[model samples]
Target: MLENPVLADLATDLPQAVRLQRLAAHLRARFRCGAVALLQLEADHLRPVAVDGLVPEALGRRFAVSQHPRLAAILARGEVTCFHHDSQLPDPYDGLLDTLVGEPLPVHDCMGTRLEVDGKPWGVLTLDALQTGTFGEDARAALAGYRVLAEAAVRISRLEREVQALRTTPPLRAGDDERGAVGGDADQEIVGQSAPLLRLLHELDVVAASDLPVLLLGETGVGKELFARRLHRQSPRRSKPLVHVNCAALPESLAESELFGHVRGAFSGAVTDRPGRFEAADGGTLFLDEVGELPLPVQAKLLRTLQNGEIQRLGADRPRRVHVRVIAATNRNLREQVTAGAFRADLYHRLSVYPVPIPPLRERGNDVLLIAGRFLELNRARLGLRSLRLSSAAQEALRRYAWPGNIRELEHVISRAALKALSRSGVNRADIVTLEPALLDLESNTAVPPAAAGATPARPPAPPPPAGETGTAPGPLRDVVDACQRAHISAALGRCQGNWAQAARMLEVDASNLHKLARRLGLK
Candidate 1:
């Protein structure tokens, strides 16, 4: 019975996170359900705290009470709420299940029980099964019996959190953070659980509460904008507006007016007096994407606003004070720009009060799959496919390939492969579609061969050195970088029997300046 295991867990001094995850997994096993999720109620949405069988992105999703009728129905009652297989209301887990068959889930039995802690709504426990009629009266009663244990688990988890908070003053837990919020969109959520991602999220959570000007530093397509929004959400100004400005997309002629507003006749396009992004984001966050791309003149004006929380309209007589928090992002090296006199030094210091470096996708091991699951579901729904899954080879291919384009590149790869899989060999949309390595279109351009997609190197490869000293990659940002980052350049050299020129050729470089570019990437 769950009584023994649940009671034993309560007795053990387990960490709060471990306890909740165990509870979800145990419940799924107990009921023999296809999936189990424990969702905590945060304001108006249900956020998954622990999930046993849902997609990786499932944890990142927030189900608004108004949007998800089944969840709302479950939360409305104290007892177990069973949605029979035939119920018409939508199931949010549709097309997101990772089953043994992995076919599209047709009719399924699903049930959930609402949980409360200290007289407040805490969360809900949900179970789903592939077979219809899997949830009978007995199952309902069993879930009802388990509800008490679930609530106890949550209550104890809460107490543990309070205790831990007093000890460490912790950041928002990953499962509870709404970088997933997403504005209620699942795609916007920060979707990974790697140590790098968790560490970054924790740092962001702590920094978000402050009024400091946060600068997000990362490669292109690292979702810096999403992190900026998360900082806004975690800050005191969440209820206020979050205005996003793409400095790179703005014209140099109009950049100043666009950011600081303009009086009529200030420029050709200026028609009337208007407030700029600072005014729009007053009492909230103003995200400056590609801030390095801002014109030098505009950067000076931005620095003024950052110094005094005020914005002066172009052609206006005086500056008006505004209370706005700035969160800036850039893929460019502002320090180098400062030294080169292209970017202002004072502006760079003002924006980078707290710089958070988001790690690249390759460094976030196994997180690639979780992110792939998200895109897979999106494509599945978009393509009207019953199911879309990665073959083991395709998944390995995804992992081994150096994702220089980062998340954006991965999105394109998945979308293109989904389409290719649909058109190739007359694969039916009604059937389960498994994407193979060839469909991914990665190996030809990437260093990893399709034949050895998942193979491990025989020995521990030496740390990669600079790329310029070795060879120049004739390949498009691959061969050299991918070999260095994913595989080892020394291993390539080893394969060439310690021949530098041969290794350079194998890495697809010019073999002249192969070992320097990596130093630019902080690799020694």
Candidate 2:
């Protein structure tokens, strides 16, 4: 039935792999009486890629590929195969399926089929019936029909394989995968498995399930604010608005009014009754970034509201009650700040009730490349590049670079690379784009030596300049201008932690102008 072109197109066009997996699951309903499971063959094992009639937690388990004799026999022949428990199936594979599933897969009730393409095993489709002697010749033939549908399903939903590949990476346990129209995969949002990050995410999961205040501590660009917003999304108050206030951005004169709201005539230029962030986030979360930057006097008032869940508008006689979950974040060393008398210790303690510390990207081995790939995929789409791949040389450079700015740096580099590739016609397919050499050379000239920070980054010797292009003849002012332009763009990017927006702002130019410069300079 899936071979009908209409059904095939619909399945192929489903934007998400989970949806396609669910489509494959529809076969369980078609077969009526048998449990169905789709298994993808990985390098060393067969894993449950998608399934129906299994317990929820069992959806992601793995088993040895060699554990099933019928599977071995079927794979060897590249054809449909069957087994009966009453037939005393041979050693190693015998009783293996029962052990794998934690139940007896009755001989008379089970049949397995291989999903092969070009005579190679891609996956397996297994169906099980509860009744003894339930599956006969006709039933097996129907299963053959289902297997045909399964192959079509696989071809139609190619991205399902990508999703399965992603699942093999141990997923973050912090937030549930957001699969609805209103949200994307929350798991993809929080990406890491380092011991510190994993523990932090587990704690985040617990905190997200509650209405308590959560404080996040990390260095700049470590994604503390992002995590604060993620907490809001996973909470019961997700339907409500999440209001953000950069405590450090507020002026000392206006900080109180900005947070606690103000009544008409409350202070100088207080012309009207204005609701504060507390009011704006009533029933939701108030994410206060740079919480440590909040002044001392303002801290007392903030603590009062956290304790009482009520705020008194400036110049207002009565206090108004508000329901808001506060998620505070800071890049500063709050404990030290509190010790030094800059931050209020009591307020610091209150905000630090359940603190989560995010690790820097350099510490997340291999994740640097994962994040880079994600950003590349996004920027490639945004920039309208049809096909793009990171050359091995580029990948090596990326892995070697110490990402001080973490995920943010990866995003900028990918965006820069994509823009560079789009503008330069042949760079995308080359063994190594010229951009990397430029980037490396620029780094050699401008990068602050790690020795200054008392550490050194091991770097590969940069590629030599192209033949006949190394000699710098004294020439027109245009050559000098071109060299100056390349140097400035690379420096600005490094200084801004690879943030295009910030670099553009610092250069007093628009982002498009910076993109043009980056393209001309080949600073990918």
C-alpha positional error of residue 24 in candidate 2 after TM-score superposition, expressed in Å: 14
lDDT by residue (tens digit), candidate 2, 342-438: 7788888888888877777767666665555445445544554433335445656766766544566466566765665557655543222223434
Model 1: worst 10 consecutive residues (lDDT sum): 447-456
TM-score of each: 0.71, 0.53
Q: Output the worst ten-in-a-row residue range by lDDT, candidate 2.
A: 447-456
CA lDDT of every candidate = 0.75, 0.60
Best by lDDT: 1
- lDDT tens readout by residue for model 1, 32-99: 88899998887777778889987565664566677678889999998889888778876767655766
Candidate 2 displacement at residue 81 in angstroms = 26
Q: Which stretches of candidate 2 lie over 4 Å from their true place?
A: 1-182, 185-188, 192-198, 425-524
Candidate 1 — which residues are off by over 4 angstroms? 11-16, 32-35, 39-48, 53-140, 155-185, 424-426, 444-524
Estimate candidate 2's alpha-carbon lDDT, on a 0 to 1 scale. Answer: 0.60
